[model samples]
Target chain A: ELKVEQNPLFLSMQEGKNYTIYCNYSTTSDRLYWYRQDPGKSLESLFVLLSNGAVKQEGRLMASLDTKARLSTLHITAAVHDLSATYFCAVSPALYSGGGADGLTFGKGTHLIIQP
Target chain B: DAGVTQSPTHLIKTRGQQVTLRCSPISGHKSVSWYQQVLGQGPQFIFQYYEKEERGRGNFPDRFSARQFPNYSSELNVNALLLGDSALYLCAAGRPQETQYFGPGTRLLVL
Candidate 1:
């Protein structure tokens, strides 16, 4: 079974500060995804890292993947109050087909609180 | 294009009762997936359907079942519900090898 672990389950940061959330998976996977979810709302895709060393950035948030280490990271730069939400990292273990029917295994999520 | 849509935003049922949830995929999307999210936890995969056929299923009990229609719409049915079954049920749509887009989810409360 694939297992995903995330660090700093709860984070509190002041506006303008920077922080990083770490996600580590136990099995081999080809794709890693980042998503943000607010209370009572659906998940919003942040980034999709498809390869090792692949990195994607949107606004003040950036995500990177390292397949060899089975790890991924989400970095926040100059955090804002609006960025307060739960962020999740998911991994899909479709090494061969690249598009299998297997669903993603998700981390517990990092609850970020950006104080203004 | 509109994102994935689900019907009956919220539902309440008792133990041993059955509930059916509906989902409509995006216009050109042929794959539909279902997930369950409990409070303070990430979503867990339930089923995946492509071309109106079951392609994948998660580690759920036999009481949980799903089916897809020709139009790419889908329904999730749960029988003999337990209190643990109360959660937010989410539906997602996408094409093969593409990112899945999720719906707002239906909140089900089992008493």
Candidate 2:
């Protein structure tokens, strides 16, 4: 089974500060994804890292993947109050010749609070 | 496009009652997936359907089942539900090897 672990489950930071959330998986995967969930809302896709050393950035958030280490990271720069939400990292297992399942295994998520 | 859409934004049911949830995929999206998210936990995959066929299932019991229609819409049915089955049910749409966009989700409360 593939297990995903994320650090700093609860984060509190001041506006304009920077922080990084880490996600580590137990096995190899074909791709990594980051998602954001606001209170009482469904998840919103953030980034999809497809290869080792893959990096993507949107606004003040940036995500990177390291396949060899089975690790991925979501970094936040100049945090704002609007960024206060839960973030999740998910992984998709490699596919087989006959076409395997494409379900995603997700981490527990990091709850971030940016104090103004 | 309109991302993904789910019907019955919220539902209240008693134990042993059955419930059915609906989903409509995004325009041009061929795949639909279902997930369950409990309070304070990550979402768990339930099923995946492509081309109106069941492609994969998660570790959920037989009580949970789903099917897709020709128009890429889907329905998730739960039989003999328990209090523990109460959770937010989410639907996603996408293609294989691509990112899945999720719907707002249906909040099901089993009393």
Candidate 3:
């Protein structure tokens, strides 16, 4: 079975602090995605890391993937209250759309709270 | 374009009752997928429909089923529901195999 595990299920940090959320998977994968979910809202896609050493950044958020280690990380830099949300990492087993039952497996998510 | 859309932002059902939830994918997107999320866990895949046919199914029981329409809209039907089925049902849309765009899920409460 393909499983995804996330570290630091909950994090509370002061403004301007930095933290990293980790996602480890049980098997090899070719794609990884980062998403942000606000309270009672749908997930908003943040980054789609496609290859080993792939890195994507938007504003204060950056995500990286390491296929060899089967891990992905979402890093928050200079965090702010407005950036508070549950961050999730999803791993898609293959780049082709026909991976079938082995679709994206998502981490349990990191509930982040930034205090002023 | 409008992102994925789901109907009845909230619902309440009694145990053993049947319920049908709806979803409309993004424009021109040909694939639709369903997921159930409990309060504290990541979303679990339920079904994936592409080209109006069932493409993938998760480890869910037969009591759960779904279908896609010509317009790429979809419906999830749950029969003989148990209290365990109380969860947030999320609909996502994408191409054959692409990053899915999620909808504001329907929060279902089972009594």
DockQ winner among the candidates? Answer: 2
Per-model TM-score on C-alpha atoms: 0.97, 0.98, 0.96
What docking grade does candidate 3 earn? medium
Q: What is candidate 1's lDDT per residue for B30-65, written digit by digit as tens?
A: 999999999999999899999998988888999999
What is the lDDT, from 0 to 100, of the residue A19 in candidate 2? 94
Ranking by TM-score, best first? 2, 1, 3
What's the number of clashes in each of the models? Answer: 0, 0, 0
| lDDT score for residue B53 of model 3 | 88
Ranking by DockQ: 2, 1, 3
Per-residue CA lDDT of candidate 3, range A1-116, in tens? 67999999999999999999999998767878888898888888898887899998999998999999999988889998999999988876664545664346788999999999
Q: Between the candidate structures 1 and 3, which one is better when assessed by lDDT?
A: 1
> Could you say which candidate leads in lDDT?
2
Listed per model, the TM-scores of chain A against the true chain A are: 0.95, 0.96, 0.93
Docking quality class, candidate 2? high
Candidate 2, A26-108: lDDT as tens digits: 98787899999999999999999999999999999999999999989999999999999999999887775333667888899
Screening candidate 1 with a backbone cut-off below 3 angstroms (N, C-alpha, C), the clashing residue pairs are none
> Per-model C-alpha lDDT, please?
0.91, 0.94, 0.87
- Please state the error at residue A59 of candidate 3 in Å: 0.4
